[model samples]
Target: MSTTPDPTYHRPVMLAECLAALQLRPDGRYVDVTFGGGGHSAAILEQLGPDGHLYAFDQDADAEQQAQQLIRGPRGDRFTFIRANFSQLHDELGRRGALGLDGLLADLGVSSHQFDTPERGFSTRFDGPLDMRMNSEHGPSAADVVAQYSEAELHRIFGMYGEVTNARTLARTLAQARNARTIHTIADLKQAIQSCVPRGKENKYLAQVFQALRLEVNEEMEVLQALLTQSAQVLRPGGRLVVMSYHSLEDRLVKNYIGQGKFFGEAEKDLFGNVQRPFESVTRKPVTATEAELAQNNRARSAKLRVAERSSLMLS
Candidate 1:
């Protein structure tokens, strides 16, 4: 809103690359589906003409506050912030009679502000409540997952989401530990599974454990899949889908959806054997932050960006 981003908010990762991928048209309509700190949303607003409109979405209340601040600022007239998850993109837009967007951008992974806030419990670096809810107001917190999930449920999430090596041991340890004491905070969870963590890789091990809990609590994968499926439906022909994912799991889903039009399996073919795909990859490989960006923003280190363009051919 002030034309200057809050220093504590997320710094846009690979900003230049993402803007270039969008190929912004002055009068085009675009959506920034993960408006963490309004970094990308503000940038998109800059590219839009007075006739252009930008819709930003976020489930986080903190982000909604930031968006409200932006909407009261200089370019407010051209921007609208939807306080909802991107998974509801279609319905939200349709309700406003706004569909067929020219482009959509999603920068995935936890925001810097979320991770840095000790109370949010996203980072292992801090000792705080094991909350980790992006929206914060709804859904089960990470503490709930750690305290209530069965050994098998914990094992499944840790193994599948975090890809932790000793997930089984960690899950068993947590189930046993929680019975003795409530795993209500980061410190409690860490102490509970300290014995299961690989000694030399404590940081990485704890990160994986936390990641599993965070993903399960938020249903991140399911939400992401929903957003992708809706993107194919709401984007106009030749519209761009620019997504930046932080982990391999998200990147794999983005890659498969763009290349195959499905999260799994091969692309379906028509009677003539022509593949029926909704979008075509603009980037054959996921782009990463340049050394210059990485030097300035350590958070960009794990970011993987992919771009796709909606197919011009109509589906039967």
Candidate 2:
């Protein structure tokens, strides 16, 4: 068997844009919650002075292993990697006496390495086990989701998360197919759902199906909500919340939370009708990749970066 080292990571989406969005401080405290391959974390460290510190969080063992390489660097002492989900941001940072963050950065979505690796199963192009958990060791695998979820539950995730056009049909198809045999691998899933795919839209439809399964298997939407909620409480006044998301669902949540301080509703109004919110929106609109950047990295095409700042006055 070949023992090739996996590539370090894909070029970070919107590298310059993300850096600018953070508005770095020489003595500030920062967090890179999605330290995939440590691209952005390394860059942030480069900008920090001796007093500045960075704490990164990732649950993936591969990512935690990769993080070790940074600890041996010249500025290693200034960095810390918490091998847990960013949803634990509050307690983890508090434990280290690292609260009152100056800025927080989250590059949300599966890392390129995870998607490209066949066994991880985030992509539809591979014929690997249907395991899509971000942590890999914990939670139910995508196979478990497919095999155990009732048709209605599968339908809910497919329609709500994937926005698959034929979500109902796809869910019913999987429900019936798995009844005959286990949909245990990527090939098994594709073959089982072949009849439900549209003729010329095979790739797009499968992508949606895979996306829905991945999101549900990982409980991504819930995790993101937890992270956003905790970020507001942790950031100090004027602290930055820089987030880059790949899909409409993630972006919508980020946009809403920053703009309204709540996930689904308007900001609450005080007695004087002053809108009370956690973070103030920095980007009037979501920032997308430039034509120049897009030419260099095709994956940057779907990226949407949104920056926000903790309100000057703390909210209850």
Candidate 3:
């Protein structure tokens, strides 16, 4: 296994852009909800003074290990690493007596470390165990989802989460194949649904299938909703919310929540006709990677960054 301190463990996407979006205050408290390789956490710590505090959260044990390395380093005193999903943001902050943050940053989706590591099973490039849980120690793995979910359930996940075409057919195929042979590995899954994949779109097809399973196994959409809802309560007035999402599903949720303070439906209005919202969007449109950043890191290609600020009005 590679050492956690290695910089290449996971190269953070859009580092400068994220920092600029936060508009950090040297003495303010901040949170990095997805401290994958501690890259963003470390950067946030750099801008902080001795009085400032930075809380980092991640459910993955590997991430926790990387966080420990950061904690033991020179500026460790300024950092607090929480080993929990960002969905538990509110409770975790309350437990630590660290509510009302000045800024909160969430770099959503699977980290490069998770993708590059074959055993983690997050990448389509490698053939490994179909286990895509961010926190490998808990929850059902991708294999469990593929092996257990009904055809209907599978179809729903593939269609809604992965946006897979012919999701029903793919789900039925998996259901039949699993009964004949267990779908435990990445290779097994690909072979099981080989016939369903489009002639020239095998990679894309497999990605959709894997994405659906990963999302279901990790409850990503629900978790993202929880985080966005809690962030409204946790951030101080004018506090920043910076989120970088790789996929449209995650980006849409962030965009909608930031714009209207709710994921589904339009914003509710007061009797006076003023819209009541928790956070006002800072970036009118989602920001994407620059050509320069894209050249250096191909992963940045799909990233969409959105920023918002806590509203001062404090709606009931």
Candidate 4:
């Protein structure tokens, strides 16, 4: 709605690079799957012709409210807000005749607003309820995972999702502690696992633990796989898939999907040994924020962007 981005809401990370990757056409249809603050959605609407449409998807109520504000703007008719997760991309788009998209952009990771809000429980710096569900209304909270998950399940997610070095020990410690007292808030969890945190490295260790719990609570990896798989079906030949990931796990999946058409192992091959793939890599490597951008936005430091183009060759 407004040209100026709301710093309090979210500052679009690597905006220039994302737009360039999209290669926007005035009459082309586009989708911004993670419309946190409507910043990027507004920018896309500005570049679109009257006939071009932009569909934005976000399950967060706050984001839905922001989309409503954008819908009341002059470019309202060209914009559609779908209050659903990107995992439902294909079905939602198909219903609106948005299939064969010109391009799709997904800036992955929690938004700045979510991270800064204490009640959202995304940040370790704040003391709040351990509720990290992106949709909030659906699924078990992080507290549920901490209190009910077995030691083995906790170990698996911590080591696999968080990449925590001392995951086994941390899981065992948490299992024992939860038996004695409730772990309902950020402060409570921190105190419960105080002995497990390495001295002088408490912040980093706490962050990893929280990240693991948040990932599990939201089923982020599975949802991301869904988005990547459906992206191929929604985009037309030569349509772009531009994704920005904040952490290594997400980046790895995006990279592998673009290069191999599958998240794990190698690409499938046809009878002639020509590799069957849905997309070809547009960016040989993940792009990082320039020093200029990093100087202005500290959060941009961890952002990594990758782009790919939908392949014309048919695949089973």
lDDT for each residue of candidate 1 in 1-316, tens digit (9 for 90 to 100): 2654575788999999999999999999999999999888888898899989999999999998888767887888989989998999999999987799999999998999999999999999999999999999999999988877789999999999999998888888889999999888899988898899887999888888888888899999999999999998889999999999988999999999888888998898889998778999988888999999999999999999999999986754
Off by over 4 Å in 4: 1-5
- Model 1 clashing residue pairs (backbone): none
Task: Evaluate all candidate structures by whole-model CA lDDT and list the values in order.
Answer: 0.90, 0.90, 0.91, 0.92
Error of 4 at 280 (Å): 0.8
For model 2 the TM-score comes to: 0.97
Q: Model 3: clashing residue pairs?
A: none
Return the top candidate by lDDT: 4
lDDT tens digits, residue span 156-212, model 3: 999999999899999999999999999888899889999999999888888888888
Model 1 TM-score, all chains together = 0.97
Runs of candidate 2 exceeding 4 Å displacement: 1-8
**Residue 123, model 3, lDDT:** 92
* Residue pairs in clash, model 4: none
- Candidate 2 lDDT at 43 equals 88
97 in model 1: Cα distance from truth in Å? 1.4
What ranges in model 3 sit over 4 Å off?
1-4
